[model samples]
Target: MKVFEPVVRLMNRLKYAQKFIVIAVVFVLVIASVSFILMQRMNSEITEMEQRYEGASYNTALKDVLQQVQIHRGTSVQAWNGSEDAQSKLASIREQANRALHVLNEQHTKQTYPLHIDEELDAINEQWQAIAEKDRWQDRDELTTLHTNLTTFIIETMLTVSNESSLQLARSPASQNLIATLTKTMPSVTENAGNLRWLGASVLAKEGDMTAQERAHISEKFYLMIEEFATIDADLQRAFTDPDIQAAVQSTYEEATAANELYATMVEQLLNGETANLTSAAFFEAATNTINLQFDLYSTSLAHLTTLMEQQLSELKMNRIMLVLLETLIVLVAMYLFMGFYIGIKRSITTIEQAAISIAEGDLTTSIHLHTKDEMLEIEHAFNKMTTGLQSLVKEIGESSQYVTASSEELHVGVEETTKSIMHVAEMMSDVSEGANEQTARLQQSEDALQHMTNDVAQIVTNSEDVAQLALTTMTLAHDGNDVMQQSSTQMNTIQQSVETTQHMIEALHGRSEQITHILQLITGVAEQTNLLSLNASIEAARAGEYGKGFAVVANEVGKLAAEARNAAHEVGTLVQGIQKDTTTSVQLMGDVTTQVRTGMDLSTTTAQKFEQIVSSMEQLSEQINGIIVNSSQVASSTEQVVTAIDAMKVISTKNMAASTEVATATEQQNASMEEMAASATELATMSETLQTLIQRFKV
Candidate 1:
């Protein structure tokens, strides 16, 4: 089979690229799945942390402390006049202050450090107890000194608490300034409150010396100054004693100290006035401002902290946005890399697919050439080698086929020549058989004429004895005729010589025909053997296939020649039988003629013995002579019949010769036809070989 170069080449090209595509696809899928899962888990943790920072429990603790400080300032003013309303208000202030202090103490108990400002606040409460003891009983001048002292005490005490708060709220510059300014202004506020009280007492004593209008004007101015001082003092007191204020201050102090300690700890946390710190006073102050920013300088601190929390939240949001952007960029880069790998793999697969298709279509010359130093390149090399081997094998097969064709042609020619020789031998045998048939016919005729002559002589001897008896009768009549005896003797002598010459001619013809018959038998046997040889040649010719078609034709001609020879042998046998019948008839006719001649001889001898009695036998002797003449004439007619049969036998022999010549000519013509057929068969075989050669170009 011829291999197509294109098909083999195509097969070689596809084998390497397939493996690369499979590995690249699997790698991309695995990497993408893991990345997606990790990003999702991180996002969930971020959401949970944000919710904890925004809860409301921290908001409520800041408001309660500010309300209690407001109540205590109101009660102290009423206690100085000694009114029942003043005492009741004073008791209420004491109870609420105690409650507020207990709450502050509870907050401090949970702290890691002490808040020293709580001791200053406790001393201020003891001064309110001194105002309760001497209410309305003391003289004006004495009352004046007590009022001045109480006011001074309240001023100094609040200044000390504010200074302490200033140290704790140090992280924010605004909270530090608010704490320092309140401490500096406290002494002036205390001195002015004392001047207003003294003015009010003087105006009440001098009302008789002035006009009503003048007294009213002085009195109203004095009262107005006193109200302004009281209002300032009450606000200060409220801010100080307020539970939210204390808690904010206490929580701030604890966190500030914790931070200082944390600086030396393994990890540090931001302190109280550090904006947006979760566990700090600034954290609680931002919550407290939402409730109590009406009268206190603490409101400024609350606003500043609120501003800082907003900025921190905004920055955190921006950081989250930047992280998301970075993650997106990384994913995009990974996707691009994956896409490049996929495209490269797909291109290789396409090349291989094309090569495979070409190979299937019978293009064996193409090669799978690859540049990579990988398994695919190795496969390509092997594929190329396979195609090279196939090309060589196909070429060798074509050469061997041509050699076989030439050898077959030579064998066919030899077989044809052998067949022709066998045919020639058969023709020669037929000619010989025809000649033998003619010879056998001539022999039969000769034998028949000889037998006739012998039978005729025996009949003549029998008649001679009859004639001797007749002579005795003639002697009895011898006294009557002597002329009759002389004529009879002459006739008998002529008849005897004719019978002896006829016998000699018959013997010569028989001997010549017997020799011809022996030769004919020899020729018949030779023809039969020749026929057998021709048959064998035909069998060999038939075995030679298309190459020996010429020889087969010649073998057929030989078979025909052999059949002709067989016919010739049968014709000769039939002619020999006819001749034997004719010879028997001729022998019977000669026997009759010979017998008459002998009888005539006997009549002549008897007549000579009876010569003395001739006078009496002369008339009988003339009759006997007439009988001898009749017998001699019959013998001559039989000899003419024998000569005519010999002439007929010679004509049959001539016809047999013509038939043999025609057979010989026909055999020669058959041999020529076989030669022509052999030539034609050779031409056909050559044509077939040429066709085969042309077909070899198509590699199969």
Candidate 2:
């Protein structure tokens, strides 16, 4: 992570386009650089192997020339020494050698060789041509010398070609040394072994005691052949040490050495002055066998070397192919990772941009979401927190605002209803006042009628004057007082009935308040449901993505508004409960006022019953006018009690007035309280509207 910190910082500073460009440039540079190095190496390897392979063909051409020339050497020696079979074979063998020379010449013409090897090849070919052109037999030793010299040139050319073409070189030590043995060491051994064959056959053909110079030549060739075999053996030993060397190389080499040892034993006869047992042909045959086996070793080694080079060339080609593919894969993978990272970063940035824009537009309900597991996830979380808090605060403010508006309206309506009730109660109080005054006047009339009755009774008792007229007057006044008292009772009863009806109406209003409160609760529940539905819509729209982005935003705003509405409904429900409580209190107060009205009605009824008794007493007084004259003092006492009853009625009427005044005062206070509540509600409503105006700025 720390290793990538610089890249991270650079990437953070760069825009997405700049980052993409940087990554693309770096990717191309790295891949191109690595590919160039590997391709150069592979090309060099392929070229070297191809050259070596091409040189193998030249070497084979040289080997063909060497083969015929080696045979040519032996036949020339035999023919010069007077072997009829050798003389017969000599011309055809020369032709074969010449044909091989022609083929090698053709090969040389097609491709240029190294200056040294090419010159050596031309000289070798010219010497072979000169030898083939000489048809007449020369001295045996001279002819052998010509053939030996030409064959030596051919072998040398082969070695030069091997060296020039890098056939003697290989990748590993064992293989390198092995190829050296085949191309350089084994070729020399085979040629020297051919030398022994010819020299020894010449000695056998002479059939005389070997001359000192000839014997010396035979001794040197035999030992040189032995020494070269030793060198080849050592080289082969080294080659076999490699684990990968063929087991057949060791087996074939052992067979060649066996043949060489046999030939060495035969050559000992020519060296030790025992030429009787060995004929020229037998000596030649034995020596040729040794050369052939040595040639077999050369051939096997060459094949192995060629195979090794081919495998090396194949491996190099495969490596080049693999390197190309690997480079391609590296490029593809690098591009994939960079593009994925780029796309991921781009997507994250887009998301952040959208969320920020939404917030800028006052859409607090828009929450940030990210799918990638990166630093952007932290940013998304932070954004979500910010939006969620803002949304909650706005929702609370809106809810409070709507609650205030509703409460204000409810308060205003309550004030109006309460003011009307106060006015109705005031009208009822005015009626009670008039009824009280009417009752007071009636009481005064009864007092005057009693005064007249007393005067009439005094006249009847003192002067025995008009007893029947006084009795009739007393009865008529009693009837009139009874009727007035009944009228007063009827008015009082009407007041009591009005109070009971007002109480019942107030109670009914309380019941209606309770029902209204229940309906408000239902509306509050509906608001909550609306909030829930908005939330569900928002969820669905979020799931819908591109198709529903606008819908999701709308739903989110709706959900917030619904939350506000639900809260407002709850607050209004609370206000309605308060109103309900007030209504219940008003009903209770009306009950109390109704009870007072009933008490006043009972007092009026008692006064009416007293008048009825006074009327009955008047009826009995007609029969007893004398008795009426004597009980006139009792009547005056009864009139005094009646006046005391009227005073009590006046006191009841005063209390009713005072009670009515208290009721009016209380209603006024309630009205004023409602008025204050309405003012507060209006102010709250204004604040609600202000909050709503601000909230509307946010789309969600």
Please report the candidate that would top TM-score against the real structure.
Answer: 2
lDDT of 2: 0.70
| Window of ten residues with lowest summed lDDT in model 1 | 52-61
Model 2 / residue 316 / CA error / Å: 2.4
Alpha-carbon deviation at 447 in model 2, angstroms: 67
Instruction: List model 2 lDDT by residue over 362-449, tens digit each.
Output: 6767876788688888877766765665566456545645664575466457545655664575566556556656655765676566
lDDT of each structure? 0.40, 0.70
Model 2 weakest lDDT span, ten residues long: 676-685
